[model samples]
Target: MKVTLDIDPGHTQDEIIIRCAELNDDLLKIVALANSSQKKVVGSLGKQTFLLEPGDVYYFECVDDKVFIYTKSKIYDCALRLYEIEEKFQGTNFLRANKSTIINLAKVRSLNPILNGKIEVELENGEKQIISRQYAPALKEKLGLGR
Candidate 1:
């Protein structure tokens, strides 16, 4: 891959043009990073509201009737439903890990097949999430590991 930095004084905002014949996994990752939005999720703790970048989230989990956002060190309350959050961030790495959780594939460190056709997902922060048998195929396909 050849990277060129052209300095054009006329342009206001920087633009990127990727010249590739085929979109492969590596290239796709680059595209994701380049096209990443400045989007934030509003999380509230007590009475204070915090703006969190979607990339900072390890996963989103719903317990009882409320949804929570899990980051590296802290968890915050989120107003959106589990499915709504997933649908809003549609082309990104977030995927449904189970019926109640959506995990960021970028935060995953490794995937290991576990018992009963399930997968034990190890996140970058040393947290574990399970990919249910029903959702295992989608995870595999997303990671380009499907048959």
Candidate 2:
């Protein structure tokens, strides 16, 4: 689908207009996302809990048993398990880079195929995540790069 964004200073409020020939699953999800009022994930740094926008999150990492939300400037502890986070961010730009990590595809800078059959994903923040060989095919399919 071709997406266009128009920024007009004359408009009073931000609005979304979808022009499609037919309604399909992808269009339905797009409408659902647009109609949803809020999409947030809670993360904490010490006692102060912050509501973080899922879009700002670079990726989620599971170290040991804890899940941490990584952003451009800070790391916050998340209460959701890796799988739970996976389910919540479904249909969005989030993709499972590995068993222990969920990466936001919007933050991806590049994908490089490595010598060991794994894919190296470089994030916009310069941090790299490895997409295991087991999940590499799925990643390629999602990006429409697979045959």
Candidate 3:
């Protein structure tokens, strides 16, 4: 793989251009990652609202009826629904681990195949979550691991 960076003094915002003869899985992943929005997300802790970057979020989980975003040490209430969050972060690092949880693949440290065709995933923060049998294939595929 070859990488080249061109600096344009007149350009206001930075831009990336990829020149490839054919798009492969790795190239597609690069495009997905590069195309992910840099827009900040709003989450509230108690009564105070906070702006969060996507990379800082470890995962998003729904409990009962409320959705929360988890970082390494903090959890904040999110205004979006599970599916809405899922749709917004599509093609990025987020993956649906189960019906109620979306995980950030960037924060995953390890994966262990458990019984019942499930997968036990450990995040960078040492928190663990299980990938349901139905969703395991998608997670595996996203990670470039065979289902």
Candidate 4:
């Protein structure tokens, strides 16, 4: 695949041209990443009350029927649900590690396999989360490892 970026000074906008002889998983991943970055999240608290930044978030979790964004400093309630947040952050280094958790791969420091088909994920901040076996395959795939 070949990617070409065309700049038009008069138009004040840039154009992207992707020339590929065949489409594969890599191409799909690139497209997904580009689309995910365009998604915006609106906080439930208030428009100006909380702004969610991808880098600042360690993970998104649904607990007690409420969605929360976990950051290094604090956690904020999100207007969107777990599934919604998962879709919005897809291809952005965030993966659904469990039923109620969407973890940032960039924030994961290490993974350890535990008993009964569960894996423990240790984040850079020393926080640990359990990744159910059902979602373990997906997490392994995202990490570029085979299950």
lDDT against the true structure, each candidate: 0.89, 0.87, 0.90, 0.80
Candidate 3, residues 1-117, lDDT tens digits: the string is 899987879899988888989989889888877766565668999999999988999999999999999998899999999999888888899999998999999999999999999
Stretches of model 2 off by over 4 angstroms after superposition: 1-21, 24-29, 32-37
Put down candidate 4 lDDT per residue, 1-147, tens digits, no spaces. Answer: 455555566876544455688878888778766775666555544445565667778988899999888888777788788988887776778888888899888899999999987889999999999989898888888888877
Ranking of models by lDDT: 3, 1, 2, 4
Off by over 4 Å in 1: 7-10, 18-31
In lDDT terms, which candidate is top? 3
Which window of ten consecutive residues has the lowest lDDT sum in model 1?
30-39
Residue 26, candidate 2: Cα error in Å is 5.3
lDDT (Cα, tens digit) per residue for candidate 2, span 36-108: 3267989999999999987799999999999999999999999999999888777777789899999988799
Please give, for residues 8-108, the per-residue lDDT of candidate 1 as tens digits.
99889888888998888788777766655556888999999999998999999999989999999999999999988987776578889999999999999
Best first by TM-score, ranked: 3, 4, 1, 2
- Highest TM-score among the candidates is held by which one? 3
